[model samples]
Target: MTSSPAAEDGVVRADVWLWAARMYKTRSIARQAIDGGKVDLNGHAVKPARSVRAGDVFELTRGNERIEVRVLAVSERRGPAPDAALLYVETERSIARRQAEVALRRQHAGAPRPPGRPDKQDRRLLQRLKKSIRD
Candidate 1:
């Protein structure tokens, strides 16, 4: 392996922190996730250049699950999953709630929807939009 950390403790970049934390598979994915507005820095959207410090909280959305983690350490080269885990602290509440939501969503995927014809409201909206766009 060949690498040197650009940061000492808290001077790490946001993408680097995200990758080291194992939030995303690759640093490029972390950057793309950041660019796609799937990741937040201290409750706001941030680019890859954003700085991270110890104790800073992050809100990351990878689908319907929202994960909240606090920065504990920072590293550029992702160490083993065990070592990478030291870089962040996850909250129990967030984990439990996310798990429950995931389970519920999975359970409901095959559930049948009420059998009915399309609603009139949908037709009206579709036609109205079509007419408006013709102008």
Candidate 2:
């Protein structure tokens, strides 16, 4: 695994650090979220290039989960899962909220789902109906 550019300085770019920590699968995606305001530092939105160091706090939202974590270590390298886990400490409140959200989703798991993929004819019919209504 290669280390990030800023790893030698004891700080890393927020996007790089987030990817390194396993918060997002890719640095580009993390940068996009940061640009879209889905992640914040100390309650204010931050740029993807913002530097992150140990003890910095982050609030990241993805789908139904909002995580608040304090940076425990800054590493530029994308390491193993266990090592990645050591990068940040999640807040207790954040943990509790995630658990509650998981439980709520589990309760809805029995809801009905569509039978299968819509066929080409069904797609054509839907398109015609939508066009007719719009016209």
Candidate 3:
């Protein structure tokens, strides 16, 4: 396997790095996230082409998860999962927060849910409640 460019140049573009590190499935998705403001580098919003170096911190939001990672290395080419994992390290606070979120979600998972679509009588009752609130 080829060594990462990080060892030679010590820098890579934000989107490329994200893809290479397995943070996103594709470079385009990484670019979209950067453009859509779902990514922040070193505490500031960064463009796809922004230079990323070792020790740079990143805050990324993917779906319902918020992640904070510190770049431990940079790579221009995608690699194996183990190699990708070596590219960055998730912060302790981020791990704790993600665990807490999972626990909270699990706690709410057992909540009693409505059986199904409301019947006509239930709809009428909801309408009445809405009307009362509006009055």
Candidate 4:
């Protein structure tokens, strides 16, 4: 069997591909993520030295966002966002899952804060309460 041109020559280091694809801010960070097991290749955890080729799939977890992308092209150099986007195609299921996670986070926003710090009178009352408790 034969592979397409991109697949044939699409081999690239996983960290480089990740950085070139703009998945991480820099190659070093990408490497760190791979070492930390935050990046998975083809359903298994991979090392930074792993090779990423066209048609390969990667699952990346960044904090609360879990992304799954299929490699479409490979580049050794980092480029503009549009160019980087050409390197991978995010799966629809991944997009939907990420969105759902975002929505879930939004639904459980942190506890509401008080309007402001206690006023002078409020502070005085609190102080008195404290003194009484200490007595």
TM-scores for every candidate against the unseen true structure:
0.72, 0.74, 0.93, 0.75
Per-residue CA lDDT of candidate 1, range 21-116, in tens? 889999999999999998888888898989888888898988667998888877777778889888888878778988899899899999988577
Clashing pairs in 4: none
Query: Best candidate per TM-score, number?
Result: 3
Task: Give the lowest summed-lDDT range of ten residues in model 4.
Answer: 1-10
Model 1 TM-score, 2 decimals: 0.72
> Could you tell me the lDDT of residue 34 within candidate 2?
97
State the C-alpha lDDT per candidate. Answer: 0.85, 0.91, 0.95, 0.89
Clashing pairs in 3: none
Q: Model 1: how far is 67 from its true place, Å?
A: 1.1
- Tell me how far the alpha carbon of residue 124 in candidate 2 is from the true structure, in angstroms, after superposition: 20
**Which ranges in model 4 have alpha carbons more than 4 Å from their true place?**
1-8, 114-135
Against the correct fold, how does model 3 do in TM-score?
0.93
Model 4 C-alpha lDDT per residue in residues 28-125, reported as the tens digit of each score:
99999999989999999999878888899999988768899999988887889999998899999999998998888888897687689999998999
The order by descending TM-score is: 3, 4, 2, 1
lDDT of 3 at 93: 99
The candidate 2 region of ten consecutive residues with least summed lDDT is 1-10
Query: Model 3 Cα RMSD, Å?
Result: 2.0
RMSD of each: 5.7, 4.7, 2.0, 6.1
How should the candidates be ordered by lDDT, best one leading?
Answer: 3, 2, 4, 1
User: Model 4 residue 43 lDDT?
Assistant: 98
Clashes of each: 0, 0, 0, 0
